[model samples]
Target: MISILFLIAVAASIITAIMGLSFLISCIWEKETRAALYAGLQFLLMLGLVFLLFYLEATAFFETATGRAGLILGLVLTGGTFALLTLRIGSNPQALQGTRGLMVGNVKRYDERDIVFARNRTLSPGLEQYQAYYELHPEHEQYDAARRKRGGPLGKPGSIDKPQDRPNVAATLASLSIPLHLSTPEKFNPSQHPEFSQQRVELSPASASARIKGYTLSIGAKLVGITEINPLWIYANRGEIFNENWDDWGREIELTHKYAVVFATEMGFELVGTAPHSSTTIASMANYASGAFIATQLAAFIANLGYSATANHLRHYDAALVPLAVDAGLGETGRLGYLMTKDFGPRVRLGAVTTDLALIPDNPVDIGVEDFCKICKKCAHCCPSNSIPLDDQEAVNGTRRWKLNAETCFDYWGKVGTDCNICMRVCPWSHANTSPHKLIRTLITRNRYSRYLFNSMDDIFYGRKPKPKPAPEWARFDE
Candidate 1:
């Protein structure tokens, strides 16, 4: 019995020490200096404890009947505690309750003009468009006025502005602007070439979906999915900039596409980890440009194949990309109000192409994100603007989900001179998709118990509020 107790103690110590060392290495590889330092300290402490335990055992401390009984009792108590925690927090008879009936039926279609991005874009105070919008929704006039008075456009001087990062931010914005021209009606019109009309290619839905997915992957898309266009996903009206030839600028948008191809591009982890700083905006714009480029190429490819297709990207989007992405089996809508994919979480920018071409639609997946998000509110707790909700999902736009305070979120952006990404930066799911994190994600997707265990472990190791990482060397122009 004494020998058995000694073996158990030694084995436990060895396992804990190995885990600590592994975590320390991961933090170092990911450039998480603070976390690495903490991990290193933890590994040392674990080693010290193991040495102490072995010394106590070598001294024959457990040879006495009382000591042996105490050792066995301690092991049983520890094991029982862990078992109780697993059963209480990890066991869920209804795994899909959080996401199953959410937005399932009778979802209220959202208006594009109601989005904060559209509201900010149309803030040309005193202009006819501006006045018309304010007159239609008088409640937003005061909020819009405040946002304009702040005068902190992207890359400009404001609360979180870094002069050294302005050039990179400006370059990112410029690159994204070029794709705006390609999103207009003029580009949507099919080619009038003599042979173009007769060059129609026919392929099965499965074959076409596979080809499109492969091509998108080749062109730098991180993820891709196909889905039939749901009318509810389309905007009720146009709110962003539009060409003069399209007379119905603010009118209800009529997108006659049969299918939608949604894809996402990765935002660099290092850049995004900078949160409200210029590096975050630089990453955001960079991914937007990449998504636009991919969507435009795919649209052009379809057009050349004698089919009508319109690219929906950063500058011009007719549909809510998140819902389209969810329906296309890309990911689940997370608590942070972003599409959380199995691979990248919310660290991706979405783009889409709407076309008349037929394609097999991918079914929406239930990977336990909605369930995990219910318990893991790290993003909400870390949000600088406090725009994310802390309570349960409520009914909004006919769907039961966490609704973000868009006004406050954008207000913070106006003050910061960049889109505040503190929530994204601190998200547990937003960790680098390496082997260790991938293993955690695999467990998280499987059952409720793993989600609770990983969430607790994540908070302990990475902290409930992680500090922002420094920008990459190239982006640090101050040096």
Candidate 2:
């Protein structure tokens, strides 16, 4: 029996050593230098401990009652700790079920004009739309004026002192010309195109849903979901695209669609590592463009299917993509005001298509994002502009959510010459999708204790305010 107990200890030590070594390798691959160092030191310490255990056995220390009892206690405690981290032992404290707690009151329709981008970019002074918007809401004038002086995010003489290099400029121009400055809504949506005004084929709701979801995945969408359209999620009117000289600018957007299919595309983990840099903006643009292309193609496919569908991309949104994504069962909103996906965390770009086609809708999921965010305020702590809220969630727009200060956040963008994505970069959920991280992510959405455990570990492994990584070689800039 004593020999058997010794053998068990040996096997347990081997398993733990493998885990430690694998994590050390994964951290190196993830470019987490600090974490890699930590992993390395931890692996060595475990190796030393294992050796010490064997040395004691060699010295016949286990013959003593005190040594045997100590070994047993150590094994028991170690087993309990691992089980606590890995097992699902209890119910969530407050995770909503099937979207039941999505809304606590009347969800008010949001005005797209109030979005920071619209207030600063599209509603430029000297435009009629700009004058009308300011006249209606004089309160925004002071904030808008401050942002205007700072110039655009890619301003050559902007806050980031580093040179904006040629490749960076080209990428920014491509993003603007392709999505924002060049294409209009009519060009983006197939249903709006005169040639595809009519549907050609028809299929049952069940078949249509499956086909659409499959196609979405095939065409670069990492995640896809379907849900009944919630009118409250739709914007009350257009604002951002008003001055692009379309008649529908600022017009009431009444999308009477019964269903909405949402798509989420994963942003490159390495690319996002270089947050607050021009490379980060490049990542954002690339994903947004990919989402636009995928959504547009899908709308055309639906038009061919004899259904009325309207694509909602970054450049042509009639509704809030995050809310639509949540309703579509893709993920839940986090405190940082981004979708926290089960697989990709907050590192995803969302696109949607609202349609009148009869399709089965997916139920909203509870991934413990609400409960996890409550304890893990990493995003709030790391936001460069202090835009994210550190306090508890409050009722906003008829729901409980952490509201980000968009104006200050965008202002920091102008100062940095890029979208300061420190929040996304520092979020523990946004960690690289390695095996160890996957294990942690599973526990995060399961037991609440895992949230607290991993939260502290994240801070220790990656620092409370982690530094941004250098950009990809091609887009690299001198510090």
Candidate 3:
């Protein structure tokens, strides 16, 4: 029986080492090579301890009365410690009611232009809005004129305009300008089509929502939720589509849809670490493609079942996705001013499909992430353009949240020829979803004390501002 017990312990230890080796490989593949090395070292250390155990049991070195008792006690203590650590797995972020009262009255209404700073000269030199903004903000006059004369980021005198760079610019422009086919509501009147079901076949709203979320996730979504249509989330008019003469609050932007199904598709970490490069853009487009696939498929499924649904994908957005995602319980807004889902943090792209279907509504979750963001400004510190806020949350658009300077952010992206994602790369919440990290996340979400420890530990484990790693071999070479 004693020999059998020893054999069992040896078997278990070997199994653990194997598991650790597999996890280490995954970490290395993710470019977390240091973490992988640490895991491997820990496994070797544990294996050495296991060898010591076998020598003690076999050689009778620990079989004397005192030695045997000491051996038994040590074994018990080790088992208890292992059990404690093992128990710290599979944590779920708590679901709490988010800010509920009416939006603050003192909040300032920001012009859509404030979110983005553009060289006024890039606009038609004599355009009324361009002339007025330049006159108002005179300090930008020289810089704006310089950039305008050079022709905006995409125009002549830019890097892309250089003769040798033409081929690259043309290729990129072709990809970026690919048309997203979007149909206006007026284009498809419901009365003209065959009668669609006014009600769902599912008996309960909860059941229908669960089925929809499951189906969406299985298709490609990393996270999914449904929320009631909030007027605040809908822009008065689509900004990119109607840049000039944007009608703000004058035109009614009502949706025939009553509910929105918000979902996110994760952009793998290794791909995002190479931001401001083609690899990063590929990762971004991959997420967008995945999101579009799932959203459109789900919408088609709903339509086939007789309910009217429309997929909001990529540049064809009718309503803002991030705010809708936050309100839908898919995630909380992070310091970078993007929705950070529990699993993927800010390292994912979002899509939404709004419909009139009677689906269960998800409450916006307040998982202490706001409090966590207060102490953790890793993203702010790493932001290339200093666009992310380092200060406390302030009232913006009637809601209390951190608002990033979009103009500076976009300008940085244009300069790099890629969307710089240093903020997402350095975020403490963007760590790999391992058992140890999940336990820390659970404690931090529930107790305020753990949040401080985690913030400090994260900065220590993964430097305060980690360096941008080189892209993978696969990314560097054009096949």
User: Candidate 2 — worst ten consecutive residues by lDDT sum?
Assistant: 91-100
Write model 3 residue lDDT over 1-479, tens digit each, in one string: 45555665667677767766665665676676565667678678767867877887778766577765665666577587555534423232332443333246553322333223323322346666557656766776676565444443432343322443344445445444432322233212122123544544443677779888999989988889899977666655333332233342123445689999999988877767765555565567667666666777777666655677877876445677887887788878888988887776788899888887789998887655777888899899988799999999788767777889876776666665555677887887776676655656666656565667779867755678777666666555233
What C-alpha lDDT does candidate 1 achieve relative to the native structure? Answer: 0.79
Off by over 4 Å in 1: 1-20, 41-100, 186-197, 242-246, 477-479
Expressed as tens digits, the lDDT of each residue in 1-479 for candidate 2 is 76677777878887788778888999999999999999898888878778988998999888799879978888898888888876775554334443446568887799988888878768777878878889999999987887787686874556473664457757866875555532465555555345655635667889999999999999999999998987888999887663356466688988888999999999888878988777777788888888888888888788777777888887788888888888788888999999999888999999888888899999787777887888889889888788999999888877888998887888788888777688888888888888988888889878778988888888999999899998878877664
lDDT of 1 by residue, 242-330 (tens): 45433455789888889999999988888888887776887888888888788888888777777788888887888999888988888
Q: Per the 3 Å backbone cut-off, how many clashing residue pairs does candidate 3 have? A: 1
- Identify the runs in model 3 with alpha carbons over 4 angstroms from their true place: 1-19, 56-95, 99-114, 117-179, 183-204, 242-252, 289-311, 316-318, 366-368, 371-376, 395-398, 431-463, 472-474, 477-479
- Best by the TM-score measure: 2
Enumerate clash totals for all models, in the order shown. Answer: 1, 0, 1
RMSD of candidates 1 onward, in order: 3.8, 2.5, 5.5
| Ranking of candidates on TM-score, top first | 2, 1, 3
lDDT of 3 at 225: 89
